[model samples]
Target chain A: MMSNTRTAIGVGAVALACILGSAQLVAAPKYEVVELAESGTIVGIVSFDGAAPAPQKITIPAGEDVCHSDPIVKEDVVVSADGKLRWAVVSLKKPAKGKAFPADDPEKPIVLDQVGCRFVPHVAVVPVGRTLRVLNSDGIQHNVHGKAKKNKPVNKSMPKQMKTLDLTFKRAERIPFVCDVHDWMKSWVIVSKHPYYAISAADGSFKLDQVPVGTHTVQLWHEKYGTLTQEVTVAAGKEARITFVVKPTEAAK
Target chain B: MTIQKHRIQLMAAIPAALLTITVLAVTVAAPGCATSTDSEPVADLSRAEALFVENCASCHGVSGDGRGPMASLLQVRPRNFSDEEFRYVSAPGGPPTQDDLVQTIRGGRTMGQMPAFPYLDHTDARLLADYVRKLRETGVAKMLVVEFADDDEIEPDEIAEIAEERVAPGDPVAIVGPSAEFRIDTERGRALYADNCSSCHGASGRGDGLDLPKDELGNPIEVRDITSGRFNGGAAPMEMFKRIRCGIPGTPMPEASALSNDEVWQLVHYVDLLAGN
Candidate 1:
């Protein structure tokens, strides 16, 4: 009788919570692993349509011998002479069912290293549940402060003697990291929920393979240009080609 | 029928009397560590919210955003509970433990701006700490929604889940003492300070070495003046040890991870001497 009374009292609050939860609160289907007979591919060129901005050099704090070895520059906008953009993240948006994330190998974990006071590979993608092994190769004092919203943020101290630290992200999001001592040091680790994600190369080309045959929304995101999406249909055993031409002015919008 | 009714009433009254005695007994026994279980969550937050508004909202703001009317008047600003990380956390990169929050509320910081509220009992302090924790969790959730507006959609449930996960405190950093054979050496500590900390903290330990450095929130922060003898973190030996070991979160202060235990002790001694302890 007491339990019944409690349930009756909670019903209204439960209803109100559900109402305020989301507009369309339908649960997304979980991804499944299956033997693939046929799969589709997505290939794209995330090119810059306008003249790429000149790379700006960041002034380093004086007195660090290792950091002073090389000049650090702003890596937000990396464009080749022919206007090919670099470091743009591209992914398929919310595929109901597709491929499973890659199996984790503890021996060969994904490494994010601090070399010469800069994060190598300004942008990296790690599958959820996989570990990111952070190394301080500079052998100097540094901290890896991950600014994560979905995952727990980590601000581990990497003193000169400490060589390696490992981190894992449970949720999918773009987490930026920085060093408190070195304010200019920054990097991004995109924890991917699915396998259909790729970072554009120096030639501005990216490819997502093993996608199920369907019309899927493709999202291209850059640190500066923001995000732009395009829809394309994928055919089984065949590749779908698309191009995302980003303009400098689109960042203003 | 009258006899049966009396028996039922007597049975109920016996239990009621026993419950009253138990409540009184517990209340009388409650003191420092007895009533303080920092890990336990409060069942109801209504009273806690009311308490926060009455005592803390003047400086911390009703929303805990650190923009209270008195915030601008204070030389050292009250911490924005929602937006900023707690400076005195023992868990590196994790949320503050309930004890950390409760102690800060009860004792306040050593700095003059945040005064101690000794009048509030331990239970009240715990309630306010729980409320402040909620504010931080809610704030992180809101921040996520805005940050990922362009990227992926985070549902309400996911937001709650993420916020809870992000704010969950981890194990406290281990505190160790100098080795048995180690001896205090202020001269070595002074040399270490010159090599490691002097660049930002100044040669004289006066916090005059560099221009105002930006914190994790990108806000310009004043470096702690060690010579002034007042530490935002407490001046106890262990407090100074933890501060150096973990470093202050969200600040430019780096942990003395490179230094050995002996070296840290030496530095601590040197700092104490500089502060005229």
Candidate 2:
């Protein structure tokens, strides 16, 4: 029992150390499949604490008619009429050894379609080892560029009507993707190591079900507001509720 | 004869089916090969935004509009980050990635108004990358793709005219003249440069950096001879500051992302001295 505790401490320390450093990637321990008698659910609401910043208007200054048809209103900070935030990502920073990503093949590809000079579904969740299928639905040219530190970066030109390009991330990462041709066409693909992640709905509510009962670090990430982290404990067969007050960091518009 | 015709038609469909299969195979295999770095740290946007104002605002403008106080007197126009399109990016023949921006920052454009910031730590460079992406996300800045009909087709005269008007198409910004108002401390500039730069750029600034690359036959490939000071980027003090901070891309010079902006300016002055300005 003492040896097992020490081994867990060793793994936890390594994971925490990787999380704290910027862009440092540590080898991850593979998730193991296990039978569990009791599991708890985590539910959360992520709300913006301040006034929503105005939508930025995207205009093509140089390649005018050849690019976008009209000025695109960026959905950076979309708040519902009822004050629910949309597209904010919530997930476990690092899960302890337990349920193996729920799905047998976490490697399934998540489709990201480019339509009307914009990315369909601005924020998408993809399990690590899963593929991100990027399809261009427009007739014009679009270049898919990825800005990531831990994963190999992607900058490929997608000729209109070409078959979809599959992007794979080896580690759990939140990658910001952009179309250089449109410039204003931007989105995110959050590649996770486990299934305990969800994007806040149009109503700003999110839940992570069947999480193994234990304490875990929860992280909330937003493109405009930045990130916030919290520690929550899970009881057997119980639900833990959380509310994240997201404030814009200096990166906020 | 009719039976032979029917069989011929059926055999002709095989290539079409095979073509579809080939496309499908290529399509299925492409995503498995897409480049996605998973080990990178999360972006720290706050830090990036702060640095952009302090280091990049003079040329890139506070709003990242590329209309800083010193707009003119430059041979190559400064990059307008707010524009969705960027000329220099990471992957071959596409828009710049975050790493491309980082590298662009590290290696100042060889023939543009941008400069190197080799002293910067990777963290700060990455933060700056995140900040730029924010501008893209918020739609404050947009870039236009400049699709040439064909590079070989454009005549030299047409190219020269556009080249002469390098800053012609950008959004209107106040054309404040050269504002490279750093107190030219040539003495300090010379000292700092002698220690760090002399080894690569050489004592006389002739670029006799001992290790010049040679062809298979052992002849030296061209290196920058700073005495002429004809950088692909401009020679403005601010431009020099950019080069110092970012370093010339595709060159031995590196970005000093860690260096203070003020220090970069001093090096710019020192480089001017080397150029006999």
Candidate 3:
């Protein structure tokens, strides 16, 4: 009888341990912070290969005074005059360990401003765990609706009276933000988990500094063309240059 | 000899009854102890699937993709679970809480487009909700795999791991109902509605507002005609309060975030008055 009791106690203990272990795993952090002795940089330019499509025109609603004043155009695919691709996010595909993200201050949080019924910057990069202040500079009733994959989606109305709303995401993913009132207003916010990421400038130039010294796979994602990857090798204290040529997708045409 | 036999019988019976009592105590207490753990109980997927097939498959699709045979006939398209799009979530945007799904299943939409399954026991409703969640998790995992197809670094296992973490629902938004002292002020509500809702819902709640409103999927959405006396969320004042506090997800309806709690109640009363409730 004593032996049977002991066996039951042992089984119950094991089951309890398993339950506790799984709960811990659910809350475990995906990325780890490590001190690096040496690191390199990856600089690249993203260019459009095909003939630029004509800018898509957006029809302004008749009575919205704030939206009617500005000429709104589709920003799904924006290219520079000299074939430089704009708004492509470039980053390392998988970085398990890296430098710590810069400390984020609540007072100076990353701003995703809504101006003239359009999200400014068209594409914004906000660090994971950092606060993103959604500003309604347009002074109109605009809702910031975020279709987030890895984070809790945000939907809140910012009327003319309400100026700002603050939010934060715990995971890294590209979230699409749109205004339902003005359906044409669209934007993307890339919540980056690591510092090894950059958005292409108007000149199509992008740089990822302090990437670990190794041959790492680089990823580029555009709103229209989807995700593309290429590999580049980096040496200690050196810079590796790579170029990504993007073409319009069938849907874009 | 008879006395000796009776004593022996009592001795055996006492031990047997004691054993039975011990077993019954352990059986009853085991489940109560398990609920104290932090981890949720493991969902019975097969049971959930069977329940979903029996009850929800007619409209929600056998695969939970919102493409059942009766889908085309419905005015409001049945929610596409695979797309991870839900309309009435307590939170602003949602991978809705399990409770949220259960509420919808039990209550259905007030408009009666989707019939209520009040006959199903609470346990069965929960199983169906879990099944819907499984469908969404699988769909999201597949989408990730496709989005990162070219990258050799992101394995299928890793994508699945990410999807599991990403699809965990956020906490339900807390709703505090109107206080006992509250009164329906339709006069104040009418003024508030004109300023806040008239642009989208029309001056008389006819839903012939500005331009056509479209959902996130770019599908043109017909605004709710409030005069019809049917609401997507529910007719209860408390339910209307929740809808006003947290906007309907996936649609163009914006939350009245700028309004005070009292003001929202006033607006709700005004809407009810408009619908002749």
Candidate 4:
């Protein structure tokens, strides 16, 4: 009888082990493997059509007690009426569908510092739920404020001390941030829900990576110029190029 | 009887162990699994106030009354927080629009005491601007009525023309701010500056580029010694941008009509870095 009891106990242990192993196997997540369909390159030049306009002369009205400096002219950086392109923001609007890229680690967050009264990057692309560390490296005091339609706006003073303002944007928005003390400071933070976005260079060039094989929409935005959208069909492992021309406003002509 | 008592104790301990395991699991998993309160969307006043005191109070006064210690020394008294009379407006007379405030903050009011706070990220500027409006409404409680003389009427187009005349002929490009390194190609920018600007601004951005003939007014116009860090105008990056974009009126400098804003901002960054170095 004692021998029989030992054999039964051994059998029960083996059955429990098999059940647990099966459970684990069944619970494992399944993901589809996607490959690039075709290899194509997308290349386009961004050009502005009109002649560069002359700078604008601005003077402090006689009564204003502001900077007593001489008359100042405004810079004309916006695209002219003749469709010139400079500093146009180009990015993929519709992301290719496939296995999502590994999410960013929250612990090792991206940083956008405000040292010496300026945003580190005029434009930044950050994933959702990622924390942005705004550091103050100036001896003088500065306020770091961000305005976003969907995300909560952050307005805080960055004293001479190196303080980090940790923030996260939950949605995608081309948010503009500035300091009240120093009026001219400005930067754009493009908080995206997905990771596929790029800012056009001063020469107006952009590239998007790891796009799954499919048709997607791309968007181009400029602070001064309006927004432009285009639909592109990207093959697997292939790059499809598209060009966008932004016309200057009538006054610029 | 002793065996029976021991068995009962063992059974009781099993239930207690299970309960302890459940509690431990809940404690460990709940914090990570629970939804965050940030999703609820609460206005964070403490954070906003902290930001205000750090950045705005220096010029706008600690109490949002436009009476900061710097206000007394500044030529254009920081906008009187209590007064709502704003001179810059896009619409004929709409309570200072958000865009107006933003544009003023971003581009900066030219030739005024207000310097561009480009260091403040765009979002930060918007938040602070909104908070300024809030403070104006709550702290000051009334917009200061600004009455303009009939002669003050200047058309936007006319203003644009005056702005154009401000550009200097051989002026260096405008740089955006201290942190504009990422936005600019410094190598290309340095070469451009050397080619177009080095003659007057000097190889090192010092004012001693080259002594040119006297202007029609007979003033010995020296290239702005940018590296010396002595700015007749404000030292803000935007201030430099404005100076580059629009030549300093009455100065020998001419506006840089060729460079784009991005290029100008890069130049501004280079100048700031060179001055600091």
Best by TM-score: 1
Docking class of 1: incorrect
Q: What's the ranking of the predictions by lDDT, best on top?
A: 1, 3, 2, 4
Of candidates 3 and 2, the better by DockQ: 3
Off by over 4 Å in 3: A1-32, A236-238, A249-253, B1-51, B68-76, B95-103, B121-172, B179-191, B216-218
Chain A vs. true chain A, TM-score per candidate? 0.88, 0.78, 0.84, 0.66
Candidate 1 positional error at B138, Å: 2.5
State the lDDT of candidate 4 residue by residue for B1-277, as single tens digits: 0001101222232222221111011111122222111111114444545566677677876445677768888876576543333334322212344555666676665545777777877666666665565543321111100110011111111221221121101222324444544466788678656644554566788766444523213444455677777665456776667655554322334344445577667777777777774
Q: Compared with the true structure, what per-residue lDDT tens digits does model 4 show for residues A73-100?
A: 3322534444445555666554434434
- If scored against the real structure, what TM-score would every candidate get? 0.83, 0.44, 0.76, 0.37
User: Which consecutive 10 residues in model 2 chain A have the weakest lDDT in total?
Assistant: A16-25
> Model 1 off-target regions past 4 Å?
A1-20, A23-27, B1-46, B153-155, B187-199, B202-204, B208-212, B254-267, B274-276
What local lDDT score does residue A179 receive in model 4, on the 0 to 100 scale? 53
When sorted by DockQ, best at the front, the candidate numbers are 3, 1, 4, 2
Error of 1 at B176 (Å): 3.4
DockQ of 3: 0.13
- What are the Cα lDDT values of the candidates? 0.71, 0.56, 0.70, 0.49
A118-218: candidate 2 lDDT, tens digit per residue: 88789988777767788766654565666543344455545444557777876555677776435567899887766778999988999988888889877
The lDDT, on a scale of 0 to 1, for candidate 2 is 0.56
Error of 3 at A106 (Å): 2.6
Q: What is the C-alpha lDDT profile of model 3 across B1-277, one tens digit per residue? A: 0001101222232222222111111112233233121223227645665677677867877656687778988987887776646677776456578888889998888664788889988998988776676666545544453454333233333544565565566567677766787887777899888767776788899888857787767788778788887887887887787777777776777767788888888988998987778
Model 3 TM-score, all chains together: 0.76
Could you tell me the lDDT of residue A242 within candidate 4? 79
